[model samples]
Target: MATRARPSACSHTDRVFLYADSLIHSGGVPKLCPGHGAMPPPEGQNMINESALLESQSLRNSVLERTDVLDRVKALSLLPDGMHVTTAMVATYFGVGLEAIKSLVKDHRTELEANGYQLLAGEELRSFKNLSGLQSHTRSLAIFSRRAVLNVAMLLRDSEVARQVRMYLLDMEYLARTQPVDNPVHRETVSLDDRIDQRITHILGKTVVPMFNALIETSGEHRKELIALRAGVQRIERRLHQHHTRLQRLEGVRDDRPTVGVMAAMDAMNGRRFEHHIAKLLHRDGCTDVVVQGGRGDRGVDIIGLTAAGQRLVVQCKRFAPYLNITSPEVQKFVGAAKVLHNADVALYVATCPFTPEALSIAAETGITVVHRGLLEEWSAGEPLEVLE
Candidate 1:
């Protein structure tokens, strides 16, 4: 007897073709200057944002380009494929609760399935897990194509960032439909210097960063130096990214943009300053009488406060480089401090970087809120931490 074939990373190009056919039949997409075409309005937009889906920026699957466009709404991190994103990643991008994303998925499952939403399990799931190095123990995982994510943005009503994304899509669509201005400047041409900068940035992000990761893992004698060098390259990339953002700015960086928010301020601070920053963030969210320990005789907790609803809150701050991972031991120590020593109702282990898979597992098992780099960016940008609510 013949067995069924396992699923692989199937292309969404068929959906794109079908959507294009629908638009053609309904006169939905606006025809543009020769080769150009207008994107549909936010309400009935089909498929995904083509601006983001363009594979021109892929450095042989090493670096994903068009990040500036995606980050306009929020910084959206992608997996190695650069085409797929997890449900949690979608939640992070929208600055909403994970449950909220699940709610959207539940309500729009049919439409999303038509646009490349997938629930992976069994042999296919195991294959993807090995390739991506994902750490979840769940029997299945939910993943979205870029088209499905854009579909979510259309239906999502809770986030200001999502609202901005919808508006941006609408505006771009209308702009493409309008007549071209003879006096208007176009960005189609790449300047020599700008092209050079793009090359350097691409190399640093795709080639050099991974090289440093490998070196740091194997080079025990100079791991710190390797990390430091990696940090310096990351800083350069960030500065270049800022420059690119200025070039990409439409009506200037919007007030809701996170790049101008707490992340920048916190990045400039030292350990003591980070403690105060966390305290102030708590105070901003209506925590009363928040106290910062300033690294003196503080066993593990760096900040303590009471929530607006009169619940005890304890936080431990770790301001590490984004490339570095917070280990399980550090989170374990915080758990002991927050629960055993302080008897806190809310325990937050906040860090500037990501946590190891083991660290995240510990946080989940112990009910600690792990505010890694992505969530910290959201929290710093005035998006209330879901745990706080």
Candidate 2:
């Protein structure tokens, strides 16, 4: 399939392109340009003196060496022909959650499909369905081609796995250009330094390079580690916020009557006792066919029922201490299992404790109603169950 050209690594300007071309041959030595940060010389500057040329050759060698090491990283494919990787494979390689990968694909369906995302169909899909025993299902499997993977890596801004994949793709592109050719005549005519310089020029102008503007020169692997570290810090901050919210909820509403009563009621109920209470509450809310799915394989939804309006409703009850907040992933999973898997028209996520901001956001997006203590009190007092529009 024909794919659109990736964005240029450098800025999208004629001057940047021209300067990027000469940067490899001019040796992008550490220089204090007036406006540009660690960029090449201006358009009309003659900075490629004899000494600079030698340094450019050395820099070219170093880039090639680093690319060679990247070539040995087994996660990268080595086939001369372009290698296609599936979305599942990419997720596994990066140690990212599969649901997150699927979410990215869903959000960028058009762009990703244009860049070589394939939905298994016709003979291939039929064979897969037969093998996987999904013969009854109509949905086709979505797979990402090599370029499509790179495209997604560029767009998955929140994932550290995608960052590493970006680094890998850049390194592989560099290696492909720098690899020695088999043509003896061409090899002899073009010196290794010239070939390396041309490859560098191509990378600077054509490829979408990750911006690393530090003073210290870093290897691709080292740069990937740094990105992963930065992502880790962000994750830590998110976790801390969740924890802080949990702490505040657990201790913040001590003086409030309704919240305190809810906490006391939750503390008194064990697993089986909690299910019994949930069933009673759901029954009292005019739900027929009320079922307590409190077993080991309850599919994450603890309660199932039908409203008076004959709408299918699913509920996930959490009988936890107030310090524990239900997370976004849990909400996402519950929403998926309820609405998608169980054919629920709407869902109620009941928890004694308050929800995290991320969880509330997910609930809002997925149309799942979060029933906190305050809402539960209203429901128990004969108020009809109402979801926010």
Best by lDDT: 1
Each prediction's whole-model lDDT (CA)? 0.65, 0.54
Candidate 2 residue-wise lDDT, 141-225, digit = tens: 6766555665555656566445433343343233233222343443344344433534553454232122221200233334444
TM-score of each candidate? 0.39, 0.33
Q: Write candidate 1's Cα lDDT for 1-389 as tens digits.
A: 33334346422332323333343335332334543322222342332343442322221121123233344445567765444699989998888999999998898798778777899999888877765556778899999876677677766878755655554454333322332233224433324455456556666665565566555544556555556666676678767865643353432223443343345445446788788878888988889868898476886798888998899999999987554689999989999999999999999999987788999999999989999877887787678987776
**Candidate 2 Cα errors over 4 Å, as ranges:** 1-262
Deviation in Å, model 1, residue 235 alpha carbon: 12
For model 1, the superposed segments whose C-alpha errors exceed 4 Å read 1-264
